[model samples]
Target: MPVRILDSRDHVLRRKTIPMVKILWKNQDVESATWELESVMRKAYPHLLLPIERLIPFSGFCW
Candidate 1:
């Protein structure tokens, strides 16, 4: 599971753009953080994103 979100960015595919977040995993270092699709992460781990959404008012997340 992820410990926290370190950063975020947009991943542009051939005809679409997807929001991605750099996730810091439990028992891992900064260098080990991996970028994952925000939508998928939200579906898989809604609880993890709740605190971050509450902290950042304008994080650009719909929910």
Candidate 2:
């Protein structure tokens, strides 16, 4: 199962969690990289993972 970066129990404050992994490119652009990452995740581990933004919706979501 793909790990959910957002809701995982961690050392940091709950509000500070950001599940999306940021990838940096040689061109210093990330717009496409983000999408690529999301795509690979969907194909490889669709059942175990979900986009963090889809769950949180707004800026603040509490558990």
Candidate 3:
């Protein structure tokens, strides 16, 4: 999967309020991708204060 993301301000549909974040990518299995992301987040920010719902991943570029 080719995953990508952008700040809400950089998105073409940034005007939308519901999604303050924009994750763009080519994903075959969304469920697996979601779990992978969650795992990574949990490891990276073990003491994160923000709720899981508020966390957003933004990847402007990928190799």
Evaluated with lDDT, which candidate comes out highest?
Answer: 1
Candidate with more favorable, higher TM-score: 2 or 3: 2
Relative to the true structure, how large is the alpha-carbon lDDT of every model?
Answer: 0.89, 0.44, 0.40
The superposed Cα distance between candidate 1 and the true structure at residue 17, in angstroms, equals: 0.4
Candidate with better lDDT, 1 vs 2: 1
- Tens digits of per-residue lDDT, candidate 3, 1-63, equal 335333333223556433233333365444433222433433554443255456866556667
Instruction: Give the runs in model 1 whose Cα sits over 4 Å from its true position.
Output: 51-53, 56-63
Candidate 2 ranges with C-alpha deviation above 4 Å: 7-36, 50-63
In model 3, where do residues sit more than 4 Å from their true spots? 9-19, 27-63
The candidate 3 region of ten consecutive residues with least summed lDDT is 4-13
lDDT of 1 by residue, 14-55 (tens): 999999999999999999999999999999998777765487
TM-score preference between candidates 1 and 2, better one: 1
TM-score leader: 1
- The residue pairs found clashing in candidate 3 are none
Judged by TM-score relative to the true structure, which candidate is superior, 1 or 3? 1
Count of clashes in candidate 2: 0
For candidate 2, the lDDT comes to: 0.44
